[model samples]
Target: MNFKDYIRVIPDFPKPGIRFKDITTLLKNGPAYQAAIEAMKQQVAELEIDVIAGPEARGFVIGAPLALALGVGFVPIRKSGKLPGETVEADYDLEYGKDKLAVHKDAIAPGQKVLIADDLLATGGTIETTVKLIQKLGGEVVGAAFLIELSYLQGRSKLGSVPVRSLVTF
Candidate 1:
């Protein structure tokens, strides 16, 4: 299926001159949502991942099912205070300052291979921090996958050598 056809483009979303690719429409459609997750699963099927880690909110929507499909576990990478018990955090730069992301302190075992998945790849700041959090716990980031990527933002540049794949690009 052409997954892009399921996405809704919202003009000037959250700010002027921004065309937001909303996935809610796609999520509402059963076949398209499954198609997206299946597409992502196929992309990373070759990567031997011990765990699937994804940042909060949208990432949960995509990662959970993908993890189940792969017969692996899904780790939640959330904002500070969202996760109970001991947690580790990595800070990322924002337009003005920075924000932090937290993952369970023991979310990944040392040397475990991790695959990061999300609904969209935007500025890459979050994904970069996510990669750091995984590394801090000694997990190797095998790949980062997304359902959509706003390539014009040049987010991929911030990811350095980490392999990134997106099913839909705009």
Candidate 2:
């Protein structure tokens, strides 16, 4: 399936001179959504992933299904105060703004291999920070997966040597 067909492009969304690639359209289509997960799953097939970690909101939407497909646990990296119990937090800047993310201190155990998932990769700040959160809790970040990646933004560079897989790039 052509994943891009299901993605809607909105001009100047949430601000001017920004084209937002909305995944809600693709997510609403069952076949398209499944196909996307399959593609991402294929990409991560070679990685030794113990669990899938994703930042709050969109990450939850994408990571949960992927985790189910991989028969592994899903760890949610939420906003600063979204999770209960001990948590590790990271503050970062985005393409359009700045934000923070947090994950439960026990979300993953020491030496656990984690694969981060998300709807989009723009500035890479969120994913990078998420990796920090995972590592702080003793989890090892093996790789990252995304549905859409704005390559021109050079998000991958921010990810260092960590492997990053994306279904579509623009």
Candidate 3:
């Protein structure tokens, strides 16, 4: 399937001089949704992940189903104060401001392999910070996955040596 066609291109979304690839169009189409998960699943087939951790919002949309497809648990790395009970948090700098993410104290057991998933990988700061939180909780980050990756931004460099997989790039 040409997943690219399912993604709508919106000019200057959330800002000027930026083209946002909107996934909502794909989400509304069942075939595109399944194709995306299958493609991502194939990319991470060799990772041997024990759990899939996705950031809040868009992450939940993709991560949950991917986790289910992979037959693994899904852990949510949410915005600060979103998770209940004891949580570990990491602060990261965005292009315009700083933001924090938190995960449950027991999101991952020590040594358990985790794959971080998100809708897009731009600067990689958000996902890298997610890995930090996973590490803080003693989880081994085996890899990271994404639906779309903006290659021009060089986000993969921020991810260090961990394996990073993506279904499509723009």
Candidate 4:
């Protein structure tokens, strides 16, 4: 299935001159949602991921299901103070300002392989920080996956050598 066909392109969303690829439409469609998950699963099946780490909000939507499909634990990388107990944080730059992302201190065991998941890959700021948080807790990032990628933003550049997999591009 061409999942991208289900995505809605909204012009000037949250800002001017930005064409936002909204996934809400796709999420509401049963077949499209399944196709997306299946596509992502195929990409990471060979990675041997020990856990799936998803960024705040949207990432949780896709990442949780992906983790379940892979039979792995799901770790959430969220904004500061969102998680219980001890946590580690990584600060990063955004197009507008700066922000920090944190993960449970013991969420990822040392030397375990982690696969980062998100709904979209924009500028890679959040993903980069998430990767840093995982490494800080001693988890190796096996691969980073996204449901959609805005290729023009060049988000992958910030990710360096980490393997990146996206189901759809625009």
Winner of 1 and 4 under lDDT:
1
Over all chains combined, what TM-score does candidate 4 have? 0.97
Question: Per-residue alpha-carbon lDDT of model 1 for 2-115, expressed as tens digits?
Answer: 998999999998799888899999999998998889989999989998999999889999999999989999999999889997999988888889788999988899999999
Candidate 2 per-residue C-alpha lDDT over 51-91 given as tens digits, one digit per residue, 9 for 90 to 100: 99988789999999999999999999988888888888889
Model 3: weakest 10-residue lDDT segment is 81-90
lDDT of each: 0.92, 0.92, 0.92, 0.92
lDDT of 3 at 54: 95
Per-residue lDDT of 14 in model 1: 75
Query: Model 3, range 9-73, lDDT digits (tens) per residue?
Result: 99998899999999999999998899999999999998889999999889999999999999999
Steric clash pairs (candidate 1): none
Residue 25 lDDT (model 1) = 100
Cα TM-score per model? 0.97, 0.96, 0.97, 0.97
User: How well does candidate 2 score on lDDT at residue 84?
Assistant: 80
